[model samples]
Target: RTLPCSGRNLLPSTCGENRRRVVRALATREPNLRPGIPDLNVLRSGIAAVLSVALAWALRSDSLLWASPVSVVPQQWITEQRTISGVVVSVSDGDTFRLQNVGPFHPTQDRHHEQSFPVRLAGVDAPEISHFGNPAQPFSEEAKEWMKQELLGKSVAVHILGRDQYGRIVGSVRYTSGLFSHDLATELLRRGFATIYRGRGASYDGDLSNLEATEINAKAQGVGIWSLPDEELPAEYKRRTRARAF
Candidate 1:
């Protein structure tokens, strides 16, 4: 079952994990779903993913929103709802990935994707060139570049939330290339390129504030943007600029 994007507290009663995986799903994947109790694990994870992917196709009903260099695609669309798993074959930017399985589809019947997927980041907002200044902030480009470099052409485990407003897969970028990885929010903070977007008033996004504090500490240490006085504007002005755009 799917839950609201703003509901983090709901997960404690849903998934066995203490943290809210629901928020992770919605914020990252923006899936179409009504709140319900869900179990998180290998089998359940596959089912939820396929459910979301099928739902996304139904909502979109258009052309392919994404493609990848080496994607595992099905010759036919999902005719029935089922779970599937795969590695990310591509990353669109800071928050989106294209995934297709490697080796072989999960041996479990109805447990894997034979096609690639295009997914959206759920909760956090990274600086898009469109939202930046007229020419766009140089740092925004840097941030995107860094994100692409870091995750592009990597293998990732995706957890689905269903379709979003645009019908893209709503999932998180977990393990990549058989290694643990940081989500977009963490990378943004690590690079000193983003803020929590507190004004947008997202639920799990506040969790990003914890990362923001880490960014502050990194800045204090003169890292990334902090290394440059010109790019380092007062917090108040930074907020104003971001607000005006997004």
Candidate 2:
């Protein structure tokens, strides 16, 4: 006769075989134990191990990392769709700005207990302004000054796309004043203050073709940076500078 264990019934034949195996294993481990009896300690340990494994399996997720805790910081802003709204407090360039009053929490570089962070425009690259004594690219100041006038102290909606290598939030910025609404990237491209970003992870909201058309029109009109005959792309300029440094 085979006894049921742990509220589960087993086939009589299989249960008898399993019992014999356990008895043999226990006897080998404890040489002085009675022939048909298992040590109470051994029985308790075996039950504990079985329960632990069952509990672990129950909590397992599809991810290989097991059951990971939910992050306080959101990890899937790009694919999962996340957005943050705040006022543009500062304009660094045609395609970069500082946003504040997001919340009581800031993801990076919290200053004086204020929720503020820098945001880089997705799907566009503006000319580099003079920094560290480097000469400014043509129309860099024009781009920056124009953005400051247009965006400084304005409330805007940011659609988060991803984070850049520099740890800046990369997103699409939408500005609304009265009844007029405009996207920062499209406006920059339209005025030739910036170019379509061809780098990796160049994400944007809305139709991509619209931005392309805007850039094409700017080029046809020979306006802003397009007026220069030998205008260098910001990405290309950065590469050249790095190569020269090396």
Candidate 3:
């Protein structure tokens, strides 16, 4: 007779008892084996569940990473008006100086509380000083010395305007206890030690007209740097000197 599993009679009648015993064993185990085997539909459902959870977590992490940089973007464009009182520690040039004990200003940050910061005088560009074997532009020494006398060790009120590309705070400084309130940039321009920066994107906040007038008067009187024949602007002088180095 043919066996139900193999569809062919491979055993003779002498082995009939052995075949009957083997058939009975398989029949008894078949029910347990079917339950022990994994179902394809159940396996696919479990994998899908795990992938969905991982995808959700990844999207949340990506959103947080994208938001971090946007939150910390520097506020360079937002102009804030702040008045700070500090003593001039050093003068870098006519247009730049170091101020100490700067504090009590608006938007109080720990860094500005009692530290020294380099300040670049806004709305003016001073002549280039002779340093590092570079030739001094006209009136550079005079400009520096003038600022030294007027501001060194002197307490002044600084009108914080913005920041320059070199990361220096740009402001208008005036002596607080002098006989006459002296705006440092105007003073420099009046003496012809510096020039009004009239380049594109120059922001003096309505003081450009006044600064230009002062510069014109200085030029007419032939004072300081204006007295030199065909004096080069400080910016142009720096560029030409740097080019020569190459």
Cα lDDT tens digits, model 2, 60-80, are 422211121122224654455
Cα misplacement distance, residue 226 of candidate 3 (Å) = 0.9
C-alpha displacement of 195 in model 3, angstroms? 0.4
| Residue 72 displacement in candidate 2 (angstroms) | 9.2
On the 0 to 100 scale, the lDDT of residue 150 in model 2 is: 83
Ten-residue stretch with the least lDDT total in model 3: 62-71
- What is the per-residue lDDT of model 3 for residues 146-245, given as tens digits with 9 covering 90 to 100? 8999888767776767777877777777784446887778889999999987654456756888889999999999999899889899989877888988
TM-score for each model:
0.44, 0.64, 0.61
Separately for all candidates shown, the number of backbone clashes (residues 3 or more apart, or on different chains) is 14, 0, 0
Model 3 residue 193 CA deviation (Å) reads 0.6
List residue ranges in candidate 2 displaced over 4 A.
Answer: 1-73, 76-79, 103-114
Q: How accurate locally, in lDDT, is each candidate? A: 0.52, 0.74, 0.72
Whose lDDT is greatest here? 2
